[model samples]
Target: MPELPEAETIARALAGILPGRVIRSVTVLREDVVAGSAPQFGAALRGKRFSEVGRRGKNVVLVLEDATRVVVNLGMTGRLVPGPGPGVPPASTHPAVLFHLDGGACVAYDDVRRFGRLRQLSRAEWTRWSRQLGPEPLSRSFTGRRMRGILSGSRAPVRSLLLDQRRIAGTGNIYAVEALWSARIHPRAPSNQIGDAGAVRLHRALRRVLRAAVGAGGTTLRNYRAPNGNEGLFQRRLHAYGREGRPCHRCRTPIERVVFGGRSAFFCPRCQPC
Candidate 1:
């Protein structure tokens, strides 16, 4: 699934290409990908014009002319591609939704696993959903004090806490691992045990990692791509996410890979002492 950086990259790409484009029609090839009835989804979007594009946590929002929001979650293996008008793009072998623009271009939502979603939410629904998320990690609200406040509770693995959407929205295994390594903290460290120094280090590391990932177009270890259909370059810069058994980037110890909370965690035993 695309996390904050991935979703943000796609949203920024869409912001560049989608403004002023009017939706002439919508084709829903898979009803499962539509949040509600396909007919209703089509009716809500048809003839609407895109105003802006934004991201909330891991979801992308396409703001429409009448304040309706087309929320998209690219659950693993989903890609959004734009092309010339009149037909679906050629790479849409598994197209789930197609948005036909009035100018003849089209944006295709292709998901191979059928796990992606497209939903139209009214202002109220949008507000409700947005309220459920934690502060954006890249925002000013996620300060060191704020991070420590969220971490000042019951025991949970620091990595696990970072993965909690309600605790630190948009961090997943990849950024969590990288951030922990950058902060020199262990994956299994207790969240509540982090001191002021550790918390401050972690807060800064998280912001740096997320910003760098977005700069690299987001890690594309799988089917992730920008709206322009370009693969991410961040994977080349990874330190701990998938470097298991390799030399630690900062220490000589071999990087260790373990399963924590059912997800693969990579860390250097020496650098990130536990």
Candidate 2:
């Protein structure tokens, strides 16, 4: 799935090319991908100019001239590609929505597994959708105090707490494992068991790993790619995730993989002691 960094990268790239361009028309190739009525989505967006692009959690928001917004959650394999000309070939193997722009450019929303969604919403509606999200990890609002508060009473594993979007937006399994490993904290450690000092360390580690991953254009373990269709470079810097049996960078201990909540977590047994 395209996590925070991947979604943010796509939003930044789209903001550069999509803003100020008017939507000539919208085509819903896969009806299911359009969360609302296809006709309603098109009617609300046709001829409206895109003013800006932003991301909340793992979703992308396209702010339109009319103050209405288009939200896209690229669940798993969704890809948005900007094309050169009118009637350009679809970018994804299975495109869900295609936006024809007045400038002769096109933005294609493709999802291989048909799990992604596209919805048109008003500003109030957008607020409702975003209200449940926790503080952005990259934002100043996510302080150590806030982290300590969120994890203070939870019996859930620290890894599970990190993955909760309502507590810390934008972290997924990949970054959670990486950050926990970097902090030398075992994934299975109960959240409440982590002291304030430990929470601070985990908070710093989360910020560090996320910032580094964003700088590297996000990790491309599966279908994740930059808007320009390039793979991310952060995978090369991975220390624990997906490095099962490989020597740990800090302790040279063999990395191990364990499944928690049916999700694979990688860690160094020696470095990230339970």
User: lDDT per prediction?
Assistant: 0.89, 0.89
Candidate 1 lDDT over residue span 1-274, tens digit each: 7888999999998899899999999999999999979999998899999999999888889999899999998888777888844554636768889898976888989899999888899999999988988889999778899999888873899999999988878888899999999999999999999888999999999999999999999999978878766899999999998998899878678999989799998999998889
lDDT of 1: 0.89
* TM-score of every candidate relative to the true structure: 0.96, 0.97
lDDT of residue 25 for candidate 1: 92
For model 2 the local lDDT of residue 68 reads 90
Return the clash pairs for model 1, or none: 85-104, 85-105
At residue 244, give the lDDT of candidate 1: 85
TM-score of model 2 (CA atoms): 0.97
* Model 1 bad stretches (over 4 Å): 85-90
